[model samples]
Target: MADSIFKRYLEKKNNLIKNRGILQATYVPDVLLHRDYQIEEIVDIVAPSLNKDKPSNIIIIGQTGTGKTAVVNYVGHELERADAENKNCRYIYVNCEVIDTPYSILYNISNQIITDPNKKIPFTGWSLEKIFNELANYIDDENKIFIVVLDEIDMSFKKNGDDIFYYLTTINEMLKNSRVSIIGITNNSTFAEKFLSPRIRSRLGEEKIVFPPYTPEQLIDILKNRAEQAFYPNVLDNSVIPYCAAISAQGSGDARKALDLLRISADIAERNGDSIVTSAHVDYARQKIELDAVVEVIKTLTDQSKIVLMSIIKTPSSNDTGSVTTGEVYTTYVELSKNLGYNPLSQRMVANLISEMDMLGIITARVKSFGRGGRTKEIDVNKVSNDVFSILSSDDIFRGMNLNQKLKKQTTLM
Candidate 1:
């Protein structure tokens, strides 16, 4: 008498993870905790839309996982109650991180609003301008209010431009009846402050809400609420939520990270044949989560950026200062690019990537000066070099490169 593979797998899985999806960042609980003021404020901002009037545009500024997206989604859908004329008001959400291009953003919105598959603009055939025109036409025809929530909206500006935003803000003038307004959610408010032109900034900044990082106690409450729903009874120890909450709060009160830590610790505990998630499980889960995040960032990097990172990793760590100079990194980057038969980016662009990667916490970089003459950044690979090396080595362009061998190989050949 042998058990089937499926039977064994199910039995093991059922030991934990009663509902894995509940723990995901995307899982929007019916109610959010400790955000009633934000909820009421957001509702009040978009309230005019209930009467078919254009609502005030909003820029929701918050550190990651303070419930920015959940609040808007909850409020947007609730606000979509039909008007007196039976106009079908809508809440359309777009993750600018995914739909980062102008053409793609317009196409997604067009497809969502256009009911007829045939009448919908061909995904490829329409010029971006014509697509924009057609998108505006379709929405105007609906004569309904549309509230668009652009999450990670900063990414859209970086990848594309402010053109789509400009159009959204001004599109109402083109419409005879319908109104389209945007609620932008972003992790970096400074991007808006620095990058957006004054005209666009003022338009979107009409009303702004900033969600501060959750206090440790707030995170504990949030994790506790989510854990109750995500795990079966007695699955988590009383201290588990508090520990995860404290760790996450230390890193800017990221509730999403808290949820992830909690969920992953449960999985780790379950895999270890433990019935209850414990604090040690949380520590192990934190390491895995952090490494996974860096791996993801590395994977999404452009080939040039990957090589740029590889250059920094391959540069010999300074014994005296423990960091490489920008010049040293650039030299390594150029050599590696030429080694792989790819033209290297200009030193300026490589420097820019260094700054970007530094911001991503991949490296530590600070400017140093040669008195009265010049300056360059002193760059040190953070402890995540192992994770970075692993991810880059897996990619085709970066294959066959090893930090230990890279310096030796280039030294011998050059």
Candidate 2:
């Protein structure tokens, strides 16, 4: 019998990662770095529950990887540990991004609180009001303080509306023997002011906590702490962690991104049979992660947004700098929309879409002044690679149109 094809690869010893799970974003450390004040504040807020009292509803706002969710999870874990004997406090974490919608959110909360199989809420076929009543009754029956952490709470608001939030906030009023406290976690700090009604906002924002972005120094400390447990001794070069932290800090100061960079860099080194992870590996990992992110963002864009993007892509540069004016993009968009039998958005609306894409880093739209003639944006698609074009082209609307032919016609007209 022939030796297995994987025999040689299997024989290669794993020397780089001591425990890869330690580098994951979901892995909460025993002690979170650079978030001492936030942790203490959360502890103080929830400590009332230990005495069988309800804590105020909390809204934790911050950018991605700023330790908002981590701090909440850490505090929840510690709270549950402290209440193990009396069982007066219960912690439930629900990621709203996954379990979005009014009915699903209520159902998820109900299922968590109602653990008995015979009394478990059905996954579907129940009205939102019914689910809320069941969830409230179960909590009141337990006579315990329930802390429900709604991570990415903004997603639920965007999908269904603020009704679920209103329900949760008013749930305590329905219970006689127990209380429910909400902890909403969101990346959008303005979510409450923009999307929520005044009543919901005032109730949910009783104790709002804003988490600031981590600086490069803070990111370095975070990465180093995780690195000690994630990698073997001498596996990572002296510069690997610093480089990862600096790159992530330069963008959003995300500790998760830094840890991801470190993990992917080590993976690349290990795959190449290298003993030590270096700054070069970190560079490769950054590029790979960025490309993957761009592809995903483009994939999730609405069809209209994709058409607007394609118009920008097909627009001819007005000068030798390889950038097109917003006017030029609008003209191309109007013609393309007409030919495709789709209603063309107004130039102002198209400009707003362009600005949105600019915010996403899909294109560079810089305002160029024209003296007294008013200013227009000079849009650059330098970051939109062929991979992006392919992703957009796979859509049904784009499948029928020849992008190259459209570009040629636009160029000839220019």
Cα-based lDDT for every prediction: 0.83, 0.87
Q: How would you encode candidate 1's per-residue C-alpha lDDT over 180-220 as one tens digit per residue?
A: 88898899969889988899999878889999899999999
* Predicted model with the maximum TM-score: 2
lDDT of 1: 0.83
Q: Which lDDT value does model 2 have at 385? A: 58
Range of the 10 consecutive residues with the lowest summed lDDT in candidate 1: 405-414
Writing each residue's lDDT as its tens digit, candidate 2 over 84-132 gives: 9989999999999999888888888888777789988888898888888
lDDT of 2: 0.87
So what's the TM-score on candidate 2? 0.83
Point to the candidate with the largest lDDT.
2
The positional error of residue 247 in candidate 1, measured at the CA in angstroms, is 1.0
